[model samples]
Target chain A: MPAEHAGPDGPGTARGFVHHACLYGSDEEFLAMAVPFVHAGLAAGEPVLAATTPANIELLRAALGDDAHALDTAETAYFGRRPVERVSAFLRYHDRRARPGGRLRMIAEPVWSGRSARQTAEWKRMESGLNLLLAGLPLWMICPYDTRTVPPDVAEAACATHPARLDGERVTPCAAYRDPAHYTASVPPPDLPPPPSAALAPPTADLPAVRRFARARGAAAGLTGERLALAVLAVHEAADHLLTADGAHVTLSAWEEPGALVYDLWRPGPLGAPVPALAGYAPPGAARGGEDGLWLARRLSESLDVRSRDDGTRITLRVAGPGDAEAL
Target chain B: MAHTDGARHRGGTSGTGGTAGTVHVGDLRPGDHACALYASDEERASILRGFLLGGLDAKHKILYLAGADGPRGPGELLEQCRFTGPPEVPAGQLEVLGPAELSPRQGELDPAALLGSLRAAVDRSRSEGYRALRITGDLCTALCDGRDVSRLLRYEALLAAEFGSGEALAVCQCDTRRCDPAALDAFASAHPRSVEVDPLIRTAELVVVRTFDPPGLRIEGVVDTASHRHLRDALQSVASVRGDVRLEMSRVEFLDLAGLRLLMTFARARAARHCTVELAGVPPHLLHVITLIGWDRTPGLRLGAAHAC
Candidate 1:
């Protein structure tokens, strides 16, 4: 059980962070489950927070009328963006509401529209990570997937992340749910198009060199201002890790995609173990031992994808155009 | 640097005897690119005092450089050297330059750029009617801040050739109390003349250039995998007990997670004693990155621009 707070007090039990993935076909079904969960938390004077799509939030507010005002809520537009950012928001709410040995309820629905396959994979991994991050807190949470918007595969992955399934008035133990470690380790990294062979930079350990290279490529890609800066920062952070811990036989491959700067840093050395599932998933400054550098790297950029290879670890960082500073 | 012979410093001895002989600061001639290692700040100040006074007395144009991290706007010059300069210092015979002026390009640190700039400064000195241009600064701070060492060694060789033209002179200084041993050895051979001194701390993992006049620590080095315990232990024994602890970081090449945490750990510990830690000389853009990651608002920490000095 990894020698932490596992066994009786760990996730996947009645003790703490009780997560349930709700699958609903229509509005009536979503409300049938969510309205009661919120009402119960209010009756018991427990903190309850709901973050869903704007349309669903209005639907919930209309059905419960005066009672819905008691539940804290934010539209998913503000609630979820990047996986690391969304998780931080939830943790902040939990910290403010949590009491010793007490229980609270939560309703979370991630924004799924316009996500690339790579981003979808990251969201699923983060959903699974919640079990570990909140393992000791008595958190009763329901994560709903709307068939109207969520694809079947997305819903299936969401179900796999939660420990239970809530249908109608019954909450049954989920047969599909897997431990976060086992489940997250199965998710694959982003499958973006490869950079042109000519774009591969020869191995070097100079930070200034790396910065210059990233800036040139990012500028060529039409990345400017804060977006370009973040891409360079991401490249700097990831390369800094290799420079610190490895022999640093690292090559950088840069490419310009439409509206974004993508960089891949491949060092010709092994990272020993696989890149941990929880790496870079934690909030900044709350990172564990090995995940420290990646935490900042991931948060500062649009995405930081880590994949261990036979020769070395290849870190891909992407910074898209004109991003809002909403992650904080 | 090529593993060849040059005058090295033997304990308490100054001579032109063997490969390990030491030279006096006053003995430096025009066209001499000398490297010196000082065991303590007092010795460093004494060496600098002798070097600066000679230049000022000789009526040479003096170019002073702060460490790689800096008083970017100038002013922290002869004051810290604990020496007085000629009235010409105010009349434009003395000029202060930061690392930025060494290389014109923003991000890439090409040693050739530095050489070209130094050569140009020499030309400017001669055109201004000075006998020679005397250049002095903490050259080791660049290496500590992760300038390409092989390239820098090459730059030193080129600097020696440039100084050989009889228009300029430089004494590249390394504080042995703070320099990496490997870098120090490279400095000895990179120059035609070397002034090797014993080091106070033999296991210095990074270069920490401290200036009491400005009241700050100029951190320059590849502090990526630095020994945390070594850094913390040294700070505990050496950090000044009074005033705020201002860290100058313009010269730092890359600080990994552990190295950064060590700085914060030290800052927080200082904060516990009711002292605030201010980060000085950090570039605005780099400071923005620090703020982006939320380290800027860390408890007992404040962001500070480079001091005018």
Candidate 2:
């Protein structure tokens, strides 16, 4: 099924807020979309950057020749590791290159290989989210996807996330571009296997006990040093937030999932209000969304998914292993 | 766990209610001899300022007995006290007596002789037309050097009994960093009251201590939802303080996002007024979160080594 709305080209694909999905099957095709994008920005004195895989950056550099000197490039693997921080990195890069009424042109490529199906979708959500987040800036961004590297459905996400598509000849409006908020709301939370009965801790509002239990679980999951600290802090924040909202006890279930530690916090009663689509993505000084602790938890952990189900809210927080940039 | 006062080296929350069953130094009246188990000279100074300032403000006689083993002598520490309110202490109303004058400055401490001197001072203050006599002894060793543990306990008990129901109030200062746990506990039990600084925040999970000199707060333990408002109130209490407001957090176990957000809010607010909310010894993990969200980038917020020592 389509991840978002699909239709014909419209004003959404126009020059203003120029965001496009650039699908390429080969190196030559990637350059065909990237070279012109970089050159056009350089010609107009706009800051041009390429945050993609090295091979593609090499291809674009080879195609652009001397003009590539003015371009900035970052490995997508590192640059887009954590979604919230990725936004900050991008905004910082753009702000640094900003000019008076000028613009920035960036070639962003989401790291697709080695990502779980759910993670791939998260990347797509970040892509769609960028359209709204960076709309006011005179920024032109193209999200390139190697159709050969990703599954058919994963490649199709680009169409739903971007306003325009450049699969071959020219940049045409993406027929499947849904609104960012609409797409984010429709996306499903990552799958978390039910914990072994022994892994579940009894529900309690005793914060100190909960803290010790969660810290022990995180350490047991092989998280250490800063990763362990981040996990513990994120858990404390989430549990504390729930306690504050409902003034109730919270159940915690934690287990190791491959290279990550997954924690599920179940609190009774419906969490007030729908989780805001842009929650936790707001920067420090920006207008905030949702609870501050939860917002920070989303940034601290690998991912935070708040789901309203089972007559309550289950907030899942994940923290990835060290040096696993892709997982981060 | 154990409501152990003085030996609070471990991270624990501070409540507005002061330490369990303790009285604020400002609340101490004549006939009250309170034992204060302090962790640092910094902490002792906080209690001392409140103690002496109250006496000075009331035009009462102030007798400061400095510890012989303390880093500084009575005369010098008195010069550095900087009571904050009164421009200068009345020369005749204030006296600096060290352990040398207390128990003969030799042999074992004589609890009887010390009581006689304290009694005489109380009588002298009354004769001088002073409203009250305030006696604060830094017994961290200055006065405790030659005395055995039992003798020290006897001296403490006698001091409390002799000063009780009189025009004199005694604040016995025991340095937790230097005093033994058994002795510290005994010292605390001797007096009818123990002194606290009117805790900015004291909860089961977190404690916030206001500091002078650098002028900020010393936060300990976890900051969760239950204590979030206390943390906010504590920050606001020091918001109007000029210069850098140092937040000492080495003992803090954890702080929630709301607590962190409140810090950034205050940090930003202070920035506009040309003041800084400097964070010293912020845990490495919390520092990462602050920097990760760019809260550390706030103009008036300096993280790490701001006043490291």
Strongest candidate by DockQ: 2
Give lDDT tens digits, candidate 2, residues B101-194: 7767575557787787788888888899999999887764544453346777788878767767767888888776676666666666666567
- Clashing residue pairs in candidate 1 (N, C-alpha, C atoms within 3 angstroms): B8-B20, B76-B309, B144-B220, B144-B221, B145-B221
Clashes of 1: 5
Q: Which run of 10 residues does model 1 chain B get worst, by summed lDDT?
A: B1-10
Candidate 1 — what's its lDDT? Answer: 0.68
Tens digits of per-residue lDDT for model 2 on A1-328?
2233222332233344678888899988888777777776787777888999988888888889899898899988888476777777788887678777676778888778898766776777788888887777677777888988988877888889998876433667778899998887778676454567537889888766677777788778766655676777788877776776656778988877776777888887765554554555655554433566676778877788776654776788877855467635
Angstrom error at residue B81, model 1: 13
lDDT by candidate, in order shown: 0.68, 0.72
| TM-score on alpha carbons, each prediction | 0.61, 0.71
lDDT of 1 by residue, B190-224 (tens): 76665432222223235454434334465543454
Q: Which candidate tops lDDT?
A: 2
For candidate 1, what is the DockQ-based docking class?
Answer: incorrect
